[model samples]
Target: MSRDEHRHIPTLKRELAEGKITRRDFLRYSSLLGLSAAAAYKFAGDITGVKFIPTARADMPKGGTLRVSMRCPTIADPHIFQWVYDSNITRQVVEYLTLTGHDNVTRPGLLEGWEASDDLMTWTLRVRPELKWHSGRDFVAEDVAWNLNRVLDPNTGSSVLGLMKGYMMNDAGDGLWDANAIEVVDGKTVQLNIKVPQIAVPEHLFHYPLPMIDPDENGVFGVGSNGNGAFELVEYVQNGKATLVARDDYYGDGPYLDRIEFVDLGDDPSATLSALSSGQVQGSYEGTIAQIDIYRGMPGVSVHEATTAKTGVARGQVDQAPFDDPRVRRAMRVAIDPPRCLELAHANSGAPGEHHHVCPVHPDYAVLPAIQRDPEAAMALLAEAGHPDGIDVEIACKGDPPWELAAVQTMVEQWKEANIRVNINLLPSADFWDVWDKVPFGFTSWTHRPLGFMVLGLAYRSGVPWNESHYANPEFDAVLTQAEGTLDLEARRELIRQLEVIMQEDGPITQPLWRSVYSAWSDKVVNFAHHPTSYIFGNTLGLNA
Candidate 1:
């Protein structure tokens, strides 16, 4: 076995033993690592005492239009998409180099396979051969190299730049872009020489914000959808609808549906629910927790749920007054009870958070002791911060996504006991995004990321564009850097422990719970599963009718 295979098999086994992955996931991952089917089945049987059987697809008939209701997608640019709704639309055309599954396993997508150096500083990617774009152009190593460079370029304003540039770009020169970081070697192979040792390179490639686009096309995606994905864009109308048809020459598995139509139901969740109820749409992008009961009662509708690391965070700008005091921030953390918030706001459908950004789903998450909620302690901290009479604050957040509003309301009521007065400023979703990062105190919705370090780097790193709190701590930043480069899981988790404590004690954000997200689709839809990250994978979905 190769060194990479040896390293991965043990990790997979450990994950399986810990109940993080199932026996089926073990077989799938082991086969991907070059283990034969018989060997993989035997290996799994020895561990779980269960026989592995492959499902026959001969009886499954496909060829129908699947309609889904979602928010209007504005920007067609793959790299600059800010919302999950927009990516859901663009993903039909473009594809990613890697795919992180619902189980949080990172698998090769466009690339046939990849190998990492011992130090994890270099990754050699082998692109799949005989793949052609929807435009009939060959997919090659240069396309991958071009997309990496584009993501690294500061001028592109790619959201992924925050997550990738620091590790992938060389800081020796101007530090804006590094041509040597991504090297194209021949037609089907490419290499990445990163500045730091990152074990989650493959998972990072599957970050929703960074889709692999056709290198020859112009920067934007709306001009034309010439991609290598299983679906080809027939038409796309921003704020209205989009239509896609299956590509006969797709390199990957079944794009079973003959066609797909995505209709924008506006920002209201009710519209989507109505569409699903009346069969106007076969599927809905995401349904709020409050709507789960309604979905359960509806006939011919299947409500799917995925326990995710996704959550909403209430943040106070550290650079601003009141919250600038660590005492005040700590007071806020202790004043609100996570369990109470989860029960009241989320209908007790999710796991409570510990005020730290890391989730239990993350492999490197450190298990810390529980923090008790103390109203008296919060009052004392406020007094120590020179707010003996209590402090009045305004929290800004979007009115949509019902759970955010529900969470904020619950926290506001809980804070009253601590002598903290809060006024809610509910803005429209569009209006809120305009000032989401600039608000003094606000709520930001976060999606599930494969790694804890990825979200921390994007949102907590000192001066990054998305750093809403404007929190700058030398010790936190240094620990984060070390944690990012550490490849050993145990050692990295040790560092994560420190980071978690620091955040709970002094960070500007208070996260109450990790959400249990829901989606509803027609009963006729087969193989349509809800992803933990809320990603829509239409290619694998089929309509039984």
Candidate 2:
């Protein structure tokens, strides 16, 4: 193919993968460029595969309950929830400013489009006009501003706010909103003034934590009480179950199903799998990697599997003793072997690496030597750090899905080789969330973010509430800030490489494996696919006519 023929194809493929255009649009545009329909679709599939096809059924049946087995956390506040299950339930009722498709591309959601200044300091978002809240109130620019303000509010106690700490101006470290930080530029446009230049504004805006909320919305002691999303709140039983009815006058397209009921399975993956197998629930997004083979061959189930950057991390709080010494942290890193832990935990389903949620799928990915388990080296470092007698520490975890617990148990055995005594403190999944941050050592399950800098900003920034390790370095923070501000692809990758080196050398979190996640549904369900982050909602899901 000539340069002219291939140049536009690259841009068109990106548009299709990012969901800026549909597969039909890709086919139409590619055909104009002298390519067959099959060729055009093949190119598009190469970019994001078929997991994200816009499934619009013409003769779809209307009004039926879509039972889901997503286990929600104790806190259901859209912004405060730490796990995917909580976000899954809240996102059904509360829509985001930007929607991230299954292809990991972000498109307009509540906002029609957005523009940023050359300096990247000021951003202007054009809201979709005439949108309304589920309570029948007109949605305005103020609603958007209020939702963001809540995230910045310390009193709101939103865990995801850690991602926006430096991005948003909060000099007091308290979540108080700066009056000049946000401006309502007329009715349809909202302007945001950042403390520093940031090119990843859309990535943060695409977060599930930034869900639009009505000013009078009551998330506490209630569930799905108020939202501007495609579903209306009908009933809620906290930590148990909830039901949502589709809104007819929803601003956007279809939430084809009449209703969706979220059944709380807690941390029992077996119960969730059994429910899907028995025809009690039509679908579930919580299928585990260990059961992929079983679900794949099941009679009435269709399993959607994809390799994700999502990882199970063991956080060693640096502010606390033994871990306070950088040598001790390094010793911990070298003491445990990731591949062995992965095999023991996930049945060899995960790839062991130094990846902190940034997988090989990212465009900026660079191969770094995987950390090998060096028990002798770890012992020397432990002795050098003034712990010649070996250090005793507690590892807290919410044992679930079987693999994570197995991984943690294997880690304990590995640490013993380095003369490190580890006490396992296993808590229920719900109880784990309560002390996830406060605990000196714990396990956290992280999902895939759109960009590498996103996870870094959320989890590693100094003094941020979610900084699991409490590991602070001036140079690390500066590199992350610079990376997020730069729009150039190559420049950003260099900065990200610097970040990877920082984490590898002295960071306090141990990310062992990245696994393949599978979501399954009954054959009766239609128009559904698993997202890389498993972030899909019920808007386009339906049943056979």
Best by TM-score: 1
- Relative to the true structure, how large is the alpha-carbon lDDT of every model? 0.81, 0.75
For candidate 2, the lDDT comes to 0.75
The residue ranges of model 2 lying beyond 4 angstroms of the native Cα positions read 1-54, 170-172, 175-178, 218-224, 355-357
Model 1 residue runs over 4 Å out of place are 1-45, 50-56, 170-179
User: Evaluated with lDDT, which candidate comes out highest?
Assistant: 1
lDDT of 2 by residue, 35-60 (tens): 43446656767765753344556766
**Model 2: number of clashes?**
0
Give the Å error, residue 132, model 2. Answer: 1.1
The residue-by-residue lDDT of candidate 1 on 417-468, one tens digit each, is: 9999999999987788789988999999999886777788778876665778
